[model samples]
Target: MTNEFSNSENLFPAYNQHEVVEKLETGFKKLNDKFINLLEENQRIKQHNKNLQEENQDILRINLELNEKNQEISRNNLESNKKYQEISRNNSNLIRINNDLKVKLQARDKQIEKLQNDLNLEKQKNKEIQRLEVISQNLEKNLKILEVDEIDINTINVFKENNEQTNCNINKNPTTALNYSKGLDDIRIVVGLDFGVTYSGFAYCHVIDENMHTNDNWPWGVTGQFRTNTVLRYDDEFNNVLYWGARALKNRKQNSEPVKLFNLYLGDLPDNLKPKLPIDYKKAITDYLREIGMFIKEKICHLDGFDYFEDVLLVLTIPAEYSEMDKVIMRQCVYNADLIKDRDSEKLQFTTESKATALNCTFMFVDCGKYTTNLTTRKLVRNDPLHIDKVTVQIRDFYGSRLINEEFIKFLRERLGTCTIDLLKENNYEGLQYMVKKFYRRITRSFTGDDKKFNYELDILYEAPILLRHVSEEIKEIMGEIIEIKYNDIKKMFDPIVDRIIRLIHIQLLNNKENCSTIFLTGDFCVSKYLQNRIKEEFSHQVNNISVPALPEVAVVRGAVIYGLSTILYGTEFDGLKLVISSRLLKFTYGIQYNWKSSDDLTHNGKNCKFKTLVKRDTEITPDQTFSFNFKPGSKQISESFAIYYTQKYNIWYCDEPGVKRLGILNIDLSDVQLDSRSINFGLTFGQYEIIASARNERNRQEHMATFCYPDDDF
Candidate 1:
């Protein structure tokens, strides 16, 4: 039984071992599956990690490339900086070079200055040699010849020029700042004129003394030169932009003065005798007029910059007897002067120069101008009428200035030679200038009682006293005759006429006829002493605008400026020029039975002839042409008439006469005359013609003749 039980246990144990083995196999199978899954997951993780590593490696390679490129770029930048440093160094060197160049230039300038000094010394030496050569050459020329008039004059002039040049050169060290060129600034000048038929007085006064100056002509930017005459001279070298009026008149003698007496020829100028340039009566007058315009422009420099001339007032004066044609010439001066500023010249008011003094000091004006005596009546209102008849206007044939001139001429003649007149005629006016200066002081002391010294040189004032005297006398004679004759004749023969004239004035002023509100009287002949009393008596009750300005001689000039402005700016009426026809004879059988001569036209014919006017005293002429009517000086056998006329287009008179026309007097007929042959015009006129009879010495029967410019017919 034990063997059997042990065998059973062994079997049981074998079975248990088999059961455990089977269980263990199941567990192993499960664990193996789990292990396989785990292995697969780990393999996937390993793959991801490998891929990440590859991507990282790629990024590292890219970064490495970028680093290499950056290093290369850095190297290139370093090279660029080195190059930049080189360029900057070059620039610095260039700046240094520029500064060195400036220093070199300064050194060169000093060297040049030294060279210039050396050259100047050499030039001086050369000039000395040249002067020595010139002296050697001129040894024969400068030989002392006999004192012939022209030779002596030339020697004196040469010596004077040499002395002046030497003086100028020596005095060039430090010249005083003169007014001639004051810091390149503009100048102001005031020129007062007192014009007359014979002698024209002038004064240059200053209003604003803005600066100090040494030149009298441009003293304080003002220049005044005057004498009792109209003479002119010029030298482009020294007096290129300079001008003088009275100074020129003073140098009329010794033939060295550049002046002439054209006063008489003013009314009778030759048709083709107009001078172009250099010097002549027309040019002299024109230049003086332009200077006057310049002076006016300078005076008003404050109004404008004076770069280009702006507004300028040019004053001119004329006598009461100035013909219409004369007025035309006077106006031309202004018009031509406009060319200076590339503008049209204009005239201002035309009043009597004498009235200026009266205006300054008195309520009335009584002046004795060269040609006539004039009186101005006033009541303060500008629109008042001036009674022409109430005033006693007088004229005479003599004047103080003219007498002085005559006396000076006599002195020169006695002191000088027979060729004195000829020398003066040869455009030599230095002598006259000297004489005028010397005589100017004397005359001023004698006439005006002013013994003040004039601004002039002694030698320059006494050279051509005779020539100056001639011109002076001429002016005085013409102007004096008018004043003296008017005074004498009005008191003697025209007392009844004066009464009639007064009554006419009474009618014109008292009635205030023809819509006339103002009566203004102006002229060189508006200040007669006799006329003053008459005007005071007649116009004492009437309204008048009597104007007397500061510059009496320039009254007419100022008036002309006003007229010009009115005409240019507005549509204003102006009286045209009036032509004057002096007395001329076409017939003269009334004086005497005289012998015939081939030389004289009146006596050329052998028979005792009776003459008549071919034109019958009616004629008209244009402004462009002159009317030349035939006439004869008073003689034993010739007859005469007075005739002349002026067209409306030539009207330039500034008178306010309603019925008083600008009439032209004509004595003879004008046949078909040639004037350029391109156009033809003709006309006729006659008024109040007169006929008279007279006899010469030792003749019984009164000669038969006619003398009148007006026709008897009222029609």
Candidate 2:
């Protein structure tokens, strides 16, 4: 108030100042009240804002949860789609499997139809055979009646005796007649398989004209290949067959290796060479045979209008030296190839290599003996009539190609290191083998009559440039290096093989007791002039005559075809033909395992009670003969086992003689017989190529089995 209204109003100014002060205080209080109200309002707004923030946070949380649920739902839909796709694929697979099963069912139906047709044909053939038998009986009777008028009383008596003996023999072997009835009359073709170690050949013949046929041609290198290489190739790891035969040779020429000598290691491998083999040899043989089967079907057995399988008879030739076990393995190889799946069928036949070769030689003797001065002028031949009978034949293993091939292989390895040879084999095995073979053939063919210069060129050995000539020492290097070989060096290789052959021939002659004036040489080795000359030179003093037929290498295969026809025509209307081998000489002494019935039996009194000889070696035998024996057990036993033993040696001196080998086991169950009261009857027959044994109990029930124990066999 102007400093209190300037005192004026000194006293009055004091009251005015006090009133102004009160108004000032009142104005300050109002502003303070407004400030307090604003504070309260701000507090209330802050509270509201805090509540709104909490609510907003809750809403945000709920929204996040909803988003997460949506994502989970999408993931579940994806999983459902994947399940549906998997189910669809499985359905497709099931449909394919159903279609495959349907195809198999149709094939089975066709097979059943074929079997039924064959059964009907077999029935018809049986009836025809019965009718022919009756007609044959009538003709025989009429011939006897007509002979009585044409001959004297003594001849008539002889005819009666001969007829009675023939009747008795026919009654003894009923199965001989059964075989005639069982044979197929619709046979149009016969096949022969000569599955040899070094070579293989196949032949076929028509029964109508009886002319043999052969597959003289083959593929992949040369023409007129009657025999292809027995070779096979596998994968790098040796798991599966890649190729076989000539095709194998082609592949081997192009950086692939092959397996050879599989034939010699069919069932048992030689100890010296076994460790070198890395794969199963039997499987290799099976694969090789499978290819051969295909070859035969495609090349030789493809007749124009007939099913080759239905009208064909297959005959396989086996080495005479092969044991029963080896024969079984050969049969298995044939079966595994699906060539002759049923061994029990009459369509399949097995003949010995020696037997067939002998028959063929005899056929030549009958055909060509009249034309050769060597046969007609010899004293031994003059004493012996030109009849095919009464002459003994000797078979030996010296007449084989194995020794020569082995020596050639040895020569290759010595000139070339095994590592280098192995590498070359991996690179071009066939080229190397073909080169060696050409040299071998050249040497064998050209080196005759003591010639010193046997020339061979090594330029064809490989694709790389190289020169091979006479060298002083052996050296092995790459393909481009010079390879030196000499005539004397080559002669050294052939010398040992020649010596072995001569030694074997000498042994064979020493073992033979029969007067064999005529000697027959056959097999692929017959193609070797050196072998032939050596044989003729060495045996000139002992043998009076020698003969080598034309196409001597094909003799075994051709003879097999002849044998098939002979069996079919035997004892039939065609039996009168001269093309028949009526008898065979046993090469081994056969016997039965015998325990002496009485201790006092003088024949075996001081000897080991083991064997009784039934047929001696060198004795002539008919294929339809049976030998009977009595079995009397001392004790009461219901079952027993017996064995058959054979000896190539002189005799079975003891039960356990080193030379005596157990041939087979025969089992007999005598439960139905009076074991303690009666003796059992047993019989053995060699009517076919294999042995057949039969046992009869007291109840008259008979059991028969073809028993042959195949032992480990080696060449």
Name the best candidate (by lDDT): 2
lDDT of 1: 0.39
lDDT of 1 by residue, 643-688 (tens): 2222222222222212223222211111112212221111222222
For all predictions, the C-alpha RMSD in Å is: 38.3, 16.1
For model 2, residues 1-715, the per-residue Cα lDDT tens digits are 8987675576756558789888999999999999999999999999999999999999999999988998998898899889889888888888898788877876886577456555545654454454455546755865867765466787677667756655554444433333333455666788888776656778888888888787777655556766777777788888777876666766444534577666666422234433244566667777877887787777655557666556777888875446645665666667777776464345667776554555556532211110010010101332122222222222122123445556666666666655555555566565666766676667666766466665454542353222233221344233345455567776676665565455545533443334447666665555567766887899878988867767777787887777777766553322121222367766777777776565555354466457777666777767656677777755556556566777776566555666787776555544333434556666665543455554444333223233342223300
Clashing pairs in 2: 7-10, 325-710
Q: How does candidate 2 score on lDDT?
A: 0.59
Give candidate 1's TM-score: 0.33
